[model samples]
Target chain A: MQIIIDPYSWLLGLAGGLLIGLSAALLLIGSGRIAGISGIAGNLLFERGPDRGWRALFVLGLILAPLIVGWLRPELRAAAPTVNAGMIVVAGLLVGFGTRLGSGCTSGHGICGISRLSPRSLLATATFMAAGFVTVYLIRHLPGLA
Target chain B: MKNLIGLLAGLLFGAGLTIGGMVQPQKVLGFLDLAGVWDPSLAFVMGGGLLVAFPAFALARRRDRPLFDLAFQIPTRNDIDKRLIVGAVLFGVGWGIAGYCPGPAIAALSALHPATLLFCVAMVAGMWLQRRLMR
Candidate 1:
């Protein structure tokens, strides 16, 4: 499939960031939750209360929205990338572990944390960006990986 | 009122993933491969995100309470401990290897991408394991 650069994509990207920021903001305003993926995911694991329903719903909406959009606009559907199952699993485990240790994921730290201008968040975001940079460098340059 | 805002926010976020071309793992992989044919598009996406978010955040901070509620709950801990560094490394490794971070991974699920499903399952498992270890 030929990849075409759609200028509309930029508008969508900007809109998406606004939505994420808005969601984080609203979650804080309404539910008093941080919309932090790790924290929300963690609550689903450790807590079995009524709050779980909203978290579940939020996640469900996240999963369902793309499908609904794709169904409406067939052009939106793109080929899935080729990656081994083992790699996928390892990657997931690593992210989960990182979230717990970091006390938040990208949404929490990069979005909500940074928004609030918390010193911890600043450190966390820097760490997050730096780590991403290193990983990309290693994967692309290292032999037998790319 | 809050739920409505949350829903709208989510819709926008979903649209952003679609438009940012972030839904495509290959695009992300390209950005990751700095030594090779690196695509600087993701940087633009990030920049665009910051462009929209930075001002909104600044404005929001000035308000004593959020539009619908009381004070913002900010995490107070500032210590750069072992957990912080190790977790970040792990996250980077995952992102580098899989080309999907948590937010985008969830977004990818809507596309019914197989790799995304596998990644999500593994992520959940990792979360469980961390809880166990922490306990």
Candidate 2:
């Protein structure tokens, strides 16, 4: 098995991760909220209350960040999708539904929850990660799938 | 004040994903494809995030309350229920298939890619579906 190592990508990922951590920290310090994208977005749609304002604004900021960055640094922007529309849709639905059912996603559970040393989050992260590894193995390595 | 902080946090989070290449489907897929030629960039992203967030959360434990709120609104649930396992597995399958999780998918909307738009729309619909099912 050959491993592909890219120092540039790793550095960029670390830098970006720092930014993500900083954002989470800021949200916690300032608003006493976890920076869980799934929770924020899901609640923004389903919940009706004073909480909507912050959720909406947070999503707006998320949407706007890439736009602003794309404008200024087009090369550094995210790439387009490689998968077909059908797969994207199906995956999106599953992610949305599953995250809500589980009460968290990578951000909520993997980042924030783990940081807080929550047992549930640790188990959830492990479960999802194992599931991901197995799923990818099936999709890519199985005889008929790939 | 809280709303403003939320916005800033979102912005930073999005930027992090984009800069880290986590917003790219291929990169995520590469990380997941452990049997194949594995890319370990995602690990660094998580590591870097945890390095900072761990300390911040520790500090938070010492504080009585946040700056803009009466109290911290952290989750306190600790049950290892069926829903958690089932939901995570399903989410993992979807993530493996499309290489887009909630955060990156939402941030990728700026690209205005048809697949991303469709994914986001479907994801919201899925969220709505879950709420309906729960009700």
Candidate 3:
């Protein structure tokens, strides 16, 4: 609970967040979409309608951007995967199912929804954040629980 | 046209996530660990995003329709329900546990880590399972 001095780069975080916001804006203005990644990914997997084409392309772009960037600057790429496989699988399942049932993820509810000032999104964001905080508290503080 | 726009938006979004450091589980966990040495970078990311998105969405609200699409396709339901709350709680727990939200996990795929690949597969399977259970 105590605030330790942050060592990470806030400037980098802000720059990245701007890009995310720009992407959402572009999607909204150009295609009338919300740029909700989970919704897009989920629909791409299950839907077979006319919307599938764009969804596929969008996901492809998401996958390729890092590869392209890494090719240009390898240092910018994500570090090696460190989380254990068991935790990864459980977390992935929960994320996938939860986002679907909830109809949004961090991007959907956190970025786009919150910016629009939707009450539902505000509440959802608060709920999830609280839940995340509590979960982390349990895992890190409650020895032997994690 | 819409496909091209989708690709562009996706690229920007993915790149932003990478640049913002959301792709790292350790960093994300640090942000989530309020009881520990909390990294406030995630808050900055959200703040920056809101700064841009707020005006952009406001502009969109004033428009009649999108440039490519005939209508602005967005969620209409406003009723807060149990499903939304429960699902979000579950997602938060999972995020806290593994530090990979949907976007960062997908974007992290370029790293080609086997665990990332496995996580993506499990995530898709989870999505499928949710639909099946609901059906």
Interface RMSD of each: 3.6, 1.0, 1.3
Error of 1 at A91 (Å): 0.5
Model 2 spans with C-alpha error above 4 angstroms = none
Residues A1-146, candidate 1, lDDT per residue (tens digit)?
A: 12435556546555656556656655665555566777776776778875666666666666566666667666654335467888889889998888887788777777777766767766776786677777877766668865
Q: What lDDT tens digits, residue by residue, belong to model 2 across residues B1-135?
A: 988888899899988988888889888989999999999999988998998899999999999999899999999998899989988998898899989899999999888888888888888988889889987
lDDT of 1 by residue, B83-126 (tens): 87778778877877777777678777766667778888898888
DockQ of each: 0.46, 0.83, 0.78
Candidate 3: share of reference interface contacts reproduced: 0.78
How far residue A88's Cα lies from its native spot in candidate 2, in Å, is 1.4
Superior candidate under lDDT, 1 versus 3: 3
Q: Identify the candidate with maximal lDDT.
A: 2
Cα lDDT for residue A126, candidate 1: 77
lDDT of 1 at A97: 81
Model 3 TM-score is 0.95
What C-alpha lDDT does candidate 1 achieve relative to the native structure? 0.69
